[model samples]
Target: MSLSSFKREFARHYNDTPANYIKTKRLEKAAELLLISDERIKDIAFNCGYNDLANFTKSFRERYSCTPSDFRER
Candidate 1:
């Protein structure tokens, strides 16, 4: 299938754009790691496929309304 066709079908079934769905899943994994692991936030972000610490912080905050460290502390 074409990229656009796949994106449309993916969004139709998932109710999220492909990029957002992937990003959300990544953030969810990060949140789980924050709660369950002793790994540092930057490492968790990297493990979750984030290349930039600042971008990870911004995305995590947007999804969870808190930084990764704050989420872990909560």
Candidate 2:
């Protein structure tokens, strides 16, 4: 099947929007990277498809209520 069909099927199965599905996956991966790697914040942002560090920081803070560094520290 096509990507769109697969996304639709997955969303139906999970009862979530495709965008939300992708965001959840990205956040999970970001948490893993933060806990397991010493990589730079900017590198993690870019690797997670965020081109702007500020935007990435905003999103990260919104989700975790803290900056990436602070999250890592805890």
Candidate 3:
């Protein structure tokens, strides 16, 4: 299938775009790690498939309405 066609079908079936689904899953894992592990935020971000710490922080904040550190504290 064409790229656009595949994207549309994937979204229809999953209720989210492919990229967004992956991103949300990554952030969810990061949140779980933050609460359960003693790892640094950077390490958690990396383990969750984010190579850039700032980008990870921004995405996490957007999803949880708080930074990773703040999320851990609360």
User: How close is each model in CA RMSD to the real structure?
Assistant: 0.5, 2.3, 0.9
> What's each prediction's TM-score?
0.97, 0.78, 0.93
Model 1 is weakest, by summed lDDT over 10 consecutive residues, at 62-71
Model 2: per-residue lDDT, tens digit, 1-74? 99999888988899987887777788768877998999998899889988898988888888889999898899
Worst 10 residues of 3 by lDDT: 43-52
Q: On residues 20-63, what C-alpha lDDT tens digit does candidate 3 reach at each position? A: 99999999999999999999999999999999999999999999
- Whole-model alpha-carbon lDDT for candidate 3: 0.96
Candidate 3 backbone clash number: 0
Candidate 2 segments whose C-alpha is farther than 4 A from its true place:
1-10
In terms of lDDT, the best-performing candidate is 3
Candidate 1 C-alpha RMSD relative to the actual structure: 0.5
Q: Per-residue CA lDDT of candidate 1, range 1-74, in tens?
A: 99999999999999999999999999999999999999999999999999999999999999899988889999
